[model samples]
Target chain A: MMDVKDRYIIDTIIEKCEGVRDPALIILQNVQEILGYVGKEYLEYVSEKSGYPLVELYGIITFYPQFKLNPPGKNTIKVCQGTACHVRGSDRILGTLEELLKISPGETTENRLFSLESVRCLGCCGLAPTIMINKKTYGRVKPSNLKNILAEYEEVDQYVVE
Target chain B: MMKPRVAFFDFASCEGCQLQVINLEESILDLIDAVDIVSFRETMKEHSDEYDIAFIEGSIVRPMDEERLKKIRSNAKFLIALGDCACTGGVNKLRNLLPVDEVVEKAYGDVYDNKYFEVEPAKAIDEVVDVDFYIRGCPIRKDQLLYYVNRFATTPPHKNLDMRFDVVPKEGEVDARSIIQYNPKKCILCRRCHVVCNEVLNVHTIGISQKGNRSIISTPFGVGLEGNKCIFCGQCLVSCPVGAFSEKSDVNKVSAMLKDPSNFVVFVVDPIAITSFIETLPGSDRDMGAEIGKIITALKEMNAKRVMDFTPYTYLSYAAQGEYIRDNRTMTFSSWCPSVQEYLEKFYPEYQRYTHPETSPANFLLKTIKSKYPEENLKIVLVSPCIAYKTSDAFDGVLTSRELSALFKSNEIDLDLYSCKKVDFDKDIEMERTYIRGVRSDYSYARLILEIAYMSKFHNLDVTLNVTPIEDYVYEFAFDSEEGFFSALLIEDMSKLRKYLSKGIEKYNLVEFYPCLHGCISGGGQVLTNSLETIDKRIAMLKEYKGVTDLKNDFISQVIKAYSQLKEVI
Candidate 1:
């Protein structure tokens, strides 16, 4: 059973999907955007409304990397692991973050505040060894500077709440 | 034309289809004489890469498999997919439900890292390489294989592969296992099995889990049927179009039993199964009785010690139902249909108390036989159109109508060749006049209930019975009586059954749920024919048989005694 908000979001997404080609993909993307992730219930609801088998919908969901089945954390830390980043010792920086956050890449922290990910490229090659936390990018970040950078987000959380 | 050099190749599979080629019996000599068997892993030790025609079995599940299949494609002039795995990706595709890495890890354990081949999602041979033709079935049908081999022998090498042959569309595997096997490769994602299991039967034992090309019809959460609510009804097997859903065959075991001189094999065939068997060999001059006689003769020729019709037990079941109703079990659900009983036991346990406690007709007859002939080493081989009976422990072996046909055809014993003669049962069983010949329609059991009600003096009976084709799946039987107006509904297909149940069926006192639309006659084990006219014709033939007989004075007392004993046991 889905909550009222999730149901409304799905209903709205389904309505927007009307008259569109490949409504299944469209509806799925919309639901993921509104809810931060696509769950089985939403997929089943969409399947029921769209008249598509849930198995086909699941196939589409798993095939594409863009679709997430789990909710994202409040803050996402994306470390560039592209060719340029690798040359600049991004692996050391990634190791440092994983140790500090106590979570592997593609996993969320226990506090639900941060998610760590090592992406192919952030497309910011000029700033090699770069790590971005919720739109704020730190260029040429070293392993030693990781704690200070993480502390800034914790401070920001208190400041915003206060 | 140098006997088109033939080779057999396998990927991820059980190689049962390849084994079928070996199991061709006497016709195997003809196949050997016609085609040069260059390579066969199961039967022959020698191998050859240079082959004009290649018969590939199993699904492509690894990168190496794709590369090998491509090589085979380049090497061979024609590539034919053998069995459900090679043709449709069969049971191998079940792993597609999970991540390849996860599946590998779970299967290989700590040694997964050292594995040579990288596991990928299983796909039909056609997905990776070009396939000229397909021999469909979990294990390819031997007769169909023989027919194709004969065609390949006469025809040119590079003919357009799409040329359809008059191949007999037989029912899939009829291996008498306790569980129904769902072959993922042959599954077309039709969801008919899921629909039938969840909706029509209300068993909810199987559903489509996982998404996309990886989706498989399985018990919820990938659990085996043993722990699940699956009643072993095998409605899913009948609904599946391909070899995706089928029962394991016990043909080898039955054959072995027949050959053993020490064994006395009793072939007990259901009357309805006789109709289905006759239907398979279309355009036969033999009527219902003639077909039965011919089948008995054929079995006898195969060394069956005693051949009997299942009508005696059918009468017993009818009598039991009558006795149950007379006992005033407020609302009685017929337990004759194993699937319906399974549905009540698994889904509607509240109604379990109301169900008749009598064992199935097959079980009763087998039990009676064993008890009466305790000294003999008796093996009961139940021949029926119903796949559900395959799971029952009462019979030593179960063969479907299609299987019976295949066995006969493979053995070169043509039913049409034999002249119909009057065949008598080993023992004369007495039946009462109260017996009614069961029809192939869905309302037949419901009619029995109504008859029982009438016989019990439930006056002013207003009965409404609905019977339709398999696709329609709507069979509702309701009756109004002066003594509290007992009403019952029988639903044929799953989708309608699901819809009907969703609305709540508290109004009806009794309900008969069938997985197949027209009861056991249209069972999964029957020959594959979707034509309504053909089915109707078969039903008409079933109606022609007078299975019921006048009861002896002692038979009534026996039924009463059995009912009393059954009540105490329950």
Candidate 2:
């Protein structure tokens, strides 16, 4: 069952989407923006309101890589796995990150603190085997440096809280 | 007329449609006489590129397939899509859900690199080239194919052909309406289930999710069906020409319960089951009553403690609803159809208040039996054409008319051989008036309810009753009075209902929706037959059974007795 707030958000999004050609997609995109992710509840609510079948709505969400079904973690780690990064041994860096965080690429940590993902390229080939955590970039990333990098973000969270 | 040279070809498919042609029995000879079999990989060793008509029987999934299909299209004067795969990219479209590379790797393993054909999403023949006609179904219907072949052979080549025989609409993708299990492997992706669910039933619960070969008929978000808005109507099961969508069989459970000495199993059958049994059973010339008798005897042989018709309970339900309406004077929705109740719960939750709280005939019977025989451990099993009843909590087991036939066949209890004796219900149950008949039509259930409402003295007031059979299966009934106005809508097919509901239901008092068109007579779990003539025959047979006319006296006495007994028990 959708709560009052979620229903309000969906209604507002649907209201804004009036006269839009692809309202189901538009509603889904707007709801994703408002809620950070398109939950099943929201999809069903939108489905009822829009009259678009839930299967079609879910299909639209999945067809686009931009839309996320799950909420992203506070800290997102993107390891460049482009040709340049591949040649510079970025596979080892990704493997190390996966081992350290206990979560593979496209998966978030148990604590919901960190998410790991592999991008084709970060446009930072000059620094091959590059890894980005949030806004900061760590070029020339190695398997050994993955633990220290993740710890740095955890330490920053502790510092911010203090 | 010169015999039109015909060839059969398949791409990515099971070639089941081609097999249907082979399974034509003696009719294959007539078909062969009509058309020259130039090339058929299924049965023929001969090969020929020359053919006036080409029957293509699968989806194009590779560049090689595309090239071959184009060649066939260019060569043949008329091209016919033979099956669901060739018609609507069938079950092979599930591959469209995943990346081509991933699919190839998973399917072929390391040998994928050595593959000659460039892999693509499975596509209907018309997607690539013009298809002159389509022989629909997972495996094309044998009779339909023969009809087309005869027409092609007899008709002039220059004459325009009618291609509208079994064509599904090319637009509006949606999911199935019921809880019928979809086996991706067996699904031909003909979209018949999708078409019937969306277009016919109007319950947009099933649709093509993903794209290409990876595409599958799935509920919204690929969630478990129980969580989805599916009404578990099982219309998709009957609509599915392939084994893709089928009812979860409770045959084994029922059989086990019957065999258990400790259990007092009660086998209750709906009135519609009589016609279905007569139709399903081979070489059984027995009428509806005789067939029901045979079925009762067969169940008795299988160790059933009690076998009874559920007609009395249906009357009880009607009486209860009639009484409630007289007292309340408020419009109440009929809860007799489980599928309608489910639809209301899922789609029209706001209208739930209007739904009559009375239990269905099957449930009422079970409750009555359980209350009457408190010491006996009763296991109620309902045998009917209704697949929706399987989801009901009232029955321990629900069997389709077809499944019941299968049980009889398996047990070697041939109905023809079984002595047809007049079977009686358990001595405790009263055999008053015979089961009501002629109320099995599209709007008949609602019509009967209205009749009952009228008999209950509600007709004394100016009551405007509007009974509209919207489609083959769906009906809308509206009742307006001086006090208030409420309408009861019965939509048999989900697709039509979905469309009506989408427009927002008008101020309705009570609504009755059925998943199967034409009520339980043509239920999803019934014996599968392509002929509408068979349904007509069954309806005629059901109508032949006498119905109670003096509802004021006969119905009132029965209702009064049942209610008094109920009050005593409480």
lDDT of 1 by residue, B426-458 (tens): 553543323343444433665555454444444
Q: Looking at candidate 2, what is the lDDT of residue B66?
A: 86
Model 2: residues with Cα > 4 Å off, grouped in runs:
A1-13, A33-35, A41-53, A75-96, A118-162, B1-184, B187-223, B246-249, B274-291, B371-374, B402-443, B456-511, B527-534, B544-570
Candidate 2 at B521: error in angstroms?
2.4
- Index of the highest-DockQ prediction: 2
Query: What is the C-alpha lDDT profile of model 2 across B1-570, one tens digit per residue?
Result: 579999999888998888898999999999989999999999989999989999999999988888889999999999989888988999999889999888888888877666574698778888999988877787677888988898889884443343546544334333233336667766667888777666665667777766656667777776656777677767777667666666777778887887788888888877676677677655645566666677788899899988877777776776667566556655566767777788888877976877765656765777787886675668988887778777767778888877787777666678777666766555444546543444434335555555555555543424556666666655666565554344466655555655765665654444565666666767777766446777778777776653435334455455546654664663
My TM-score estimates for the predictions, one after another, are: 0.54, 0.62
Q: Per-candidate RMSD vs. true structure?
A: 17.9, 15.2
The best candidate in terms of lDDT: 2
Which digits, one per residue and each the tens of the lDDT, describe model 1 over residues A85-141? 999999999998888877898788776788888889888899998999989899988
